[model samples]
Target: MENISFQTAEVGDALQGSNPAHLYPDIFNQGSIHTYDAAMDQAKQMVLKFLNSQKKPFSGITPNKLAEQFKKIDFDNPLKEYEALFKEVDELYVQHATAFHLPQYIAHLNCPIVIPALAAEVLVSAINSSQDTYDQSAGGTLMERQLINWTAKQIGFSEEADGVFTGGGSQSNLMGLLLARDHFALHKYGHNIKYDGNPLVAHRFRVFVSDKAHFSNQKNASLLGLGEQGVIKVATDERFRMSVDALKDAIQAELELGNIPIAIVATAGTTDFGNIDPIENIAEIAERFGLWLHIDAAYGCGLLLTDKHKHLLNGLERAHSVTIDYHKSFFQPISSSAFIVRHKSLLEIIKHHADYLNPEEQDYEEYPAQINKSITQSTRRFDALKLWFTLRLMGRHKLGGYMDAIIETSKQTAGLIDSDPDFELLGDSDISILVFRYAPTHFSHDTLCDLNQYIKKQLFHAGEVLVASTKVNGKFYLKFTIFNPLTTMNDIRFMLNAIKTYGAGYLQ
Candidate 1:
């Protein structure tokens, strides 16, 4: 909290001089081009300095203290100089920022971005291209399309496949569900959901997913006018993968209750446990029932690049749609993800055209506008550039190698935890996340829960190591999302020791 300090100026002291445009950094100004150059140099140096100086994952600043510091700043007063602005930003953000790139920060699905992606980010921000239409971003549109096609091919889709880059997995999942709902409605009831808004049979629409599937499925269901009840949770096996028999039973149960099973969502990698549902078996059931099958491979999509582990995602090609988050495993920055469909025609449900942008009457084959296949997002960022840069610079095999290392390390960590007498391993994951907690032999269930939670908080406050927390069967447990290839057995051991220390201290 002490790192951030600001001086407040009265409202009258604001706006130093006339022509504020010159005061601020602008890239377009011919005369002030020198200023832009100097600013870029300073920005690059600041980033390098922070990257070099980061010693720990977090700064351990309490929320109350940081909130008080934030109260000192007034938005009306602006720092005109780059140096001052950079200094303030460093104090307020950089120092306290979570260094996810660190091996000690094995808490989330946040993968350390590749250098090429960072370079792409710089170009993305500076160019500020919108990927909605060709006029706005011609090369970007083509690049994005190429990336989508490449991803579809990776998932074993035919040349008829297509997709769009989205903010993240949630948006991709929503797109999948929306397409499924509309497609089902049109085929069964002869109703256009886009024109009529959730057919009369919408209440009967049920989506089947493993109990371990992402929570966004339920939320996306609600957004599609199908309540959370619309999502039927099929039971998982001992490995936490969706049970094929359980899935059939749940679908049959839904049908018995007069509910329509429109789609089945199989998770490629669940957040807490990294468990992947049996996609091949699930796809078989979906096909049997004529239901749309969506593979939520937001976390597990990285396997597509890894020849060693890609067999784990056997039936992805059979899915009607799939979500891929390149940021999670491909080592790209945040918000680099796509929603790909087997057939491009399925995306027509959400298609809308404005004469000013994508004209409805125009020959789309001649002029391909991205908005014709997207929903809600009219002005989209050129996130595909980051993945393009990653693929082109690092190559798929090198990136996939990282995934292999992460999985191996994760398995080793799980074994280490399972072998240890002081800990309890709850569930396993197909990728790299481990769910476990600090527990001594004699500790009661409720007592162990409290102890693990306190350990999580203590670890956070210590700021030496960072880990995630989740609950299983209403009992608290610590989670290790070891997606970073840099994380090793030594780092895992250090984090485990920290947890033990915290647990022992709490009991004492």
Candidate 2:
């Protein structure tokens, strides 16, 4: 071999130089310790600056204008400098991003992420653990399992309970329904739908959900090869909760029609009203009919940690499976959610025996792999770390306090809307979400609906505030989802005033 300088190295030398032991001092090179530290420090400062500069919930930029600005960017060539790239990101992206931390951004289920969860995100990305198997993630798998057990205990499940982290409440709901479908098949007809395709009688399989339940139930039924018709929309009470009497009637009608009832999905926190169904009464109905009960507690799972409102989820323990979204009320980042089952053995329905991943018979006994239970994704992110870190640093009580504060804020907001002559409170809130409309004395139903819709559009375009809109009984309503613990009465008053101002202008 010929002696070659680094600048004019041969193929062999270049290959060796590409190794981790020999690399350039840049952020892209893992071997460069100095680059990593400097890059992280710069990123931290940029985040802090952005946070400090965001005084409003949004940038007020119109969609067309933002799209035109983004189209000007050239991706054909690299900027070659972190500073230049970061500057572009700040000006074009971060500046226009919605600020969920702001008190005025009460649009959806989004929450301000906790500091500990942010810290855990840094570590999680650095390690890049795919928590699907034990070999790929030794401690990560165990940590996730332990967290699932803890959550199960919090929900009053027995020691036989088990669960796995999912992408979100939607996926969790899918998994819950999937298990229900398979278990019903096995129990009723001694058939394994997972191995065999959809049974011939699958069309007769019915799943009951409240009319106000999340739309995922119908979607899940469709995805499970049970057509949309498989989902029977049971009537809801005045509070937007599933009516146990209506449920009994629906089940009886299904039985009369020679239909098989697979499961009954009870909503712990409905999307628009935040109303919780009568779980105790629903559980009784499920047991009497021998139907699987699945509770979608995505928004109300925070009550599990609250001392005062935990009773709201009184019959949650009787559920066959449950879906909980920590990101909604637990203050964790997006995608921190889990689908838990009352019986660990029920998870075997989705288990697979891949030799390379989780062998059916291991050489030695150890913790089971997560892939054995997860039905949605194979390459999963370590989302459990976010909740784990949050619990470790903030404790359950502090997290519950955040939930309590937001719930109280909803109550106060309802009171304010009722007291204000310009606004009409639609119904009471069971959680942090309240649905009401802008109703003036002179406006008709159609005019009030249009006014409320116009107000939401104006505020969104102006970017001063962000609220959601929904319709109840063919009338438009402005929704206030108060999940920010920092949101005070003053903030609520300001939001209300802005809505009034916009409504008045639209009318004029």
Candidate 3:
């Protein structure tokens, strides 16, 4: 046989020679790590400036304009391009960024991320590991698994639970619902539905959620092909929490109509009112009906950190699955969320086989074959690294303290609202959110709501603050969502005073 060149040599050369530390000795130290440290410091300064001055709400960049701009960019001379882009960005657009860290930013559920978590983000991104497979993300996968165990324990689930990081609360809810849908259907009908599609496991599958549940629950139901109408929105009580009696009645009604109750979604903390559904009561109902229980505790997942609020999610252990958002509750950056299942094997619903990605078979001794599980598996980012860093730097107790502080501050703000005769505190504060209206006189309920909505719009146009509006008892009212720890009672008071001051003319 003639001596022939093989591709293995080329692969080996590509792997070893492509290492920047070896190829670019001038920009890097021969062996000392300080050179890389200095480079990282420079990159950090440049990145921080970019972040501080980035545009808010994405600068309203149109797709066509963005496409044209992308085409004009060149990477051959990357450093020049980088400098020019940074200059343009810092000069033209930095002031428009949403001032999330500012004390007055009390409009939405967003809050400034913890400084430690923010720092970890840059370091984690620089490493860029994919978390889907073990080899690709050996330490990263282990970190995620450990974090999942901690969260599962926090929720009072058994040691057999498993979870995966998702894009956000929305994707977390989808994964939770997807597992619930598939698992319940398979247990009742058979596993064939996994491949064929939604067969007649029952005439129709129904999901029960309170009126105060986040819209994502219904949205997920629709996206899962369960139909938007499949979500049964049960009535809430005066405090906006799901009424157990109403839920029982709704479930019985579904049974009477010959519909299958697939899942009962109990929310730990609602988005609008911060109302927590009666988990213990709902758990009993779910157990009796043999329905899958899912808790959408995305916004309130931080409650797990506090002993006081932890009991609020008393029956979470009974849940088949749970959706929690670390971004909202843990003060991590955006896109930190998870879908947790009590039984680890239930994740198989998301598993699918592909010959190209994971060949059918491999030698068990030499190579371990990959199991295709997870809702999304291809080209995934290592989001879990930052989360692991967050948990390590700030233990569960400290994280819980942060949550307690927010809830306590909310209570104090409600007290301030109550002391003022001009303000009507919507309901007694139990969670971190308070929805109220500035009503000084004998205006009808409907009229008071209209006045509050008017004030909300006026505040937005003025660009001073952004408060939300929602209806209660068919009457409109302005809502103050206090997710930012930087927000104080004084800020809430100022916002109220502003509303009443600017809306004084509308009062008459």
Candidate 4:
């Protein structure tokens, strides 16, 4: 085989080389280490440009225009040089990608990633280990296990607690619902749902959640053989927290109607208002009714690390299960989250043993495989490494400080809106998310809705400052989810000014 520069190697060179290994990428066998290094250097540069650039978070590029760019690209033809490919990628993705780290990006639940976690991402991708079995992952498996252990401790779980990392809040929510459905069947009627499938009475199985709860509950119910109607939406208090009084009434009403109350889902951090469902009150009710309680703390899990704010998640320790999204609150990259159970044995409801892969191990402690505990996935990425790296480097207190900062910023921003005559503050939150709108008193409700919607569209199209929009009680409201700890009062003011500027223009 001729010594061909991997970066500049083309199909013509492989034709001359006798070694067939040159025909395909040898990255799997360490054959293209130099090329890998070059690719990393190029990627680092691309991202550095994004970090240093003064450009807007969004490119203000329309879908049709962006689609036109992709439509012309010929994927079939190979680029001989890595530099050429990187340039094309820079134009297509990096230039137009949403920059979450920017201070003006106070929209949605997207968070700015910490530096330590990004370093971990490089290790995760380069290793390319599937966490299904110990043999496949080796040290990576134990790292993920220890991270789970740490997360369980953070949730106040005892020694018997266990969980597995999942893709994100959606998958974690699905696992919680799945376990709720199966565990109810096995314990209540001694029917094994794993093999027996959903029982005949599955139609009567009901899951209770607050009206302000994430929409994933209904979708999860649909996936577990329970239709959307099977999930009940209990009323919430003025702050958007689940009403304890209403929950009791809902359960009694369901029982009277002959519907089985299988589980109760409490939101530790709701999407719209960011208010937490009264978890302690709900947990007590769940215990009295013998209903499984799952806390969806996907957006609020960071409260577990904050000394000042950890009290906000007081009853999470008592819940049967909890969902945590490190990507959202912990400032980690995407796809880093976990679904944890109070009792390790509960995970058996979803466990499966494969002889060829993760064969039955009598002593699970000695030979453990994560695939046995996972549902809806056989091959899992080493996403846990990012969180592990974060803890080892930054420690819990430092990362929690980030959450505290964002929360404090949100409180100040809410007060700003309250004092402003032009903007209307809808409600306060337990965390950092605030739902408000640019409502001038003179405008009718219908006109205000159109004006706020126009403001959101205008800001997005101009790419000046991005803010989220949500409808509250059939009225349009703009939401500011301050997830970036570095986002100062100035950034919030900048976003608000843009909304007002656009709102004023809309009236003209």
Candidate 5:
């Protein structure tokens, strides 16, 4: 690699700097306090502009057009002027960025962030604390631990429960499976899967999950070296919840085949349908079969705080491990998630005695390192701060109210879809997500599918609204993942009207 050094003195002098100054007033080049202040001011102005600017959920720019616009910028050269660079960024990225705050954006799990969480982002970014170890993030670690304990209590976990902030639900699920894998290995064959690699009994190890569960289970199995086939897809009920009877049958079949059932992953909120599995029933099955129960509650974990819908997570407390994504349902930003374990000692599976990072001697200390419990990422972000700031500033009920509002909106959306002759509602939503497809009278299944797909593409290209598409029993369906509390019934009506309008055009 070739490196080029710029003469800071000459550059600063040329930029009209008599006192100590930075050659370039950027975040990375914090040579002077004034430079940092100036950069922050510029950032504030840019954020204000981006927020205030009234743009659609999307920009309606095609990939080729975006590519052409981006091609104008030369990465090798530097735009030293902060204003000019921000302007370029605004034009190239911000203008085209998906607006999750928009009520019309009913695409995925992305939610409009709360203001307090956004404020916390400023502090989190400035401090850049790594929550891997105590030495690196003392206050950050404590804050994370406090938040973890708070969440555990909310989920009705015992005092033996503990957790670590993770990147997101996927990593959390991975950690849950990793812990289950190790524990199963040790219990079954007295082997350590982590150090000894895959145990001799690993071939027979099987994990059961709902057919509608997040795809992360298969990915986690593959990442853990148990090929994707290690995951057994249990059948779901009519409402798309994991069927306990089907799970029992699957377990019996696995046992009949001489396979070792390791874990049963019950979902609190499935990705597409937003259906919650029967956790209590599944927990009973897990206990009877001696299987590790893991609940992937990434989307519906917010119900823990909801006054009305908290009962939806009836048996979440019984899970050995749980994945919670604050970003998805708690209205926090990305990367705010955690993997909680009921028994804190089970987390010791990921522990490593790195003399430089987290020495084994620190185990005797009152507060052990956070990295010891985390299964992924040695250098982790202080994501817990986002949730802490949210709780402190907004309080618990207000946050729960936001979830209540969205859930109500989802019900209203489902009603609209059900009443409309042009659409067909798929199933009941346990959370704030509705899956339905545009269906016109006397239309063939193939034609309806094509029309629905076309409507989605046209709306996406026109930047009017953004919704998601999925398949249910070989048929296409449009999904509305309503997480924005600001979304009203009128917004739902408008989205449906647009879908109908586009569907008519496609049929014509």
Candidate 6:
């Protein structure tokens, strides 16, 4: 046997430019590896240093500043410039950033995404699979299909259910509305309108949603050419769930005004209060009016994972379509969302053909085309992989258990607020979101609002901890979104203490 020869490479020499084989024989034998290693190490170090310096979770940079910074970077010749620029980035950008890793990051609807999902995100990015078609994604496509079926089953939908991975809840909502729009229009006007566009029919298409419903539904309506005026914002009861009587009134009013009530959008997990709209009641109204029903369960969809909280979303099965975001409540990374329809053929609303992309011959007896059934971007990312990997790794039982713990923790926080003389509970917490305001000894509601707002600004600038703020009934309140598994009852107590300490000065 011939003796194998090996060569060692030095990092500093590689940075200064070295032999291709000596630097990275495995990946870039014909190219230099030292430069790449040096670049990656410096990049990693710079990121670490920057993160260490930040006082807040983010740089708070404006779009103009961010755009300017992007333009200033020399992408074509970055190695040398990156080494030098990263040092300045250390001094300027990184030092001002807020670190989310700390126990104090309790603010916003955002959560500390699972580490496994993060790893999976990196893997998916490196591979760059488009899950829109079987041919492009191959095994990846199969993974998404399996995940769709599994999630549908989890949500109590039949085994024949089908769905598409979306960018996020907003996109998911848009896709759902698009389907609803087409379903209603096709049934009324006859034939697909998604491809050819709505045929300016006599009836003015419109949708109904509660005042507590996410703005995404209205936004989706506008994007689909229905216009913001097309969405009828129904009234909510004291608990913020859609009032069934108000919904019926709205539909009747729309009909009286000679408008087409195409769909009714119900919310599960409202942004401010985490309230679940009365889905069953809304479904009954939809059924009565013969309108398509959609549930925007963006933040509350995780309840389906647990039988304990599943009853909160009882009417979800009756929805013609539903939207779920893993990023919000499932401890998954951003952009992990899906839109599911009860009937697979309902997606025919988005059906169309383009010979260049998906040809005719592809539609055979054995393998038919699956391209025309989607409304969003053509090159969809393999977002389902992270979600699939997450379920497989931490089964639904564990996921639900984790959520139950968080919800219980949130209740404890709410209890603490209600008991504290300095704090007042605003609305109730359904999942993990608690909204409350400081109630200083003699301060009025207005004064309390101002005080809580001040405390929020102070805490944000302090960078020691973070919490979100929202307004209810014209009063400002602090929002505790307990998505971080690391966030504990102690953390909640510390936050309450911080608010009292910082807000006491605002007391009358």
Error of 4 at 259 (Å): 1.1
After superposition, which runs of candidate 1 have C-alpha atoms over 4 Å from their true positions? Answer: 1-31
- Measured against the true structure, the TM-scores of the candidates, in listed sequence, are 0.94, 0.95, 0.84, 0.95, 0.94, 0.86
- Residues 396-456, candidate 4: write the lDDT tens digits: 9998899889889989999999999999998888898898889888777779988989999
Global lDDT scores for all candidate models? 0.89, 0.89, 0.76, 0.89, 0.88, 0.77
Model 5 regions lying over 4 Å from their true place: 1-31
Cα RMSDs, all models: 8.5, 4.3, 5.1, 5.2, 5.7, 6.3
Q: Which of candidates 5 and 6 reaches a greater lDDT?
A: 5
lDDT of 2 by residue, 1-508 (tens): 9996665457556666666444456634446776788778889988898799999999899878878878778889779877988898888889999999999999998999899999998878878889888877888998999999999999999999999999899999999899889999988889999899788999999999999999998898999999999999999988889988899999999999999998999999999989899999999999998999999999999999889888999999999999999998898988799999999999988987878778878742475689988886888889899999999988999998988898898898888889888778878988988888888887776688788989999999889899998988788888998989999999999999999899889867
What global local distance difference test value does model 2 have?
Answer: 0.89
| Deviating ranges (above 4 Å) for candidate 2 | 1-30, 363-365
Number of clashes found in candidate 2? 0
TM-score of 1: 0.94
* Whole-model lDDT, model 1: 0.89
Per-residue lDDT of candidate 6, residues 308-382 (tens digit): 888898878888888989887888877888888887878755766677777656752244333555676788788
Clashing pairs in 6: 50-94, 53-95, 54-95, 54-96, 54-97, 56-98, 57-98, 107-467
Q: What is the lDDT of residue 337 in candidate 5?
A: 94
The true-versus-predicted C-alpha distance at residue 449 of model 2, in Å, is 0.8
Answer with 2 or 4, whichever has the higher lDDT: 2
Error of 2 at 93 (Å): 1.3
Q: What is the C-alpha local distance difference test score of candidate 5?
A: 0.88
Give one digit per residue, the lDDT tens place, for model 1 in 117-198: 9889988987889999998998999999999999999899999999999999999999999999999999998999889898
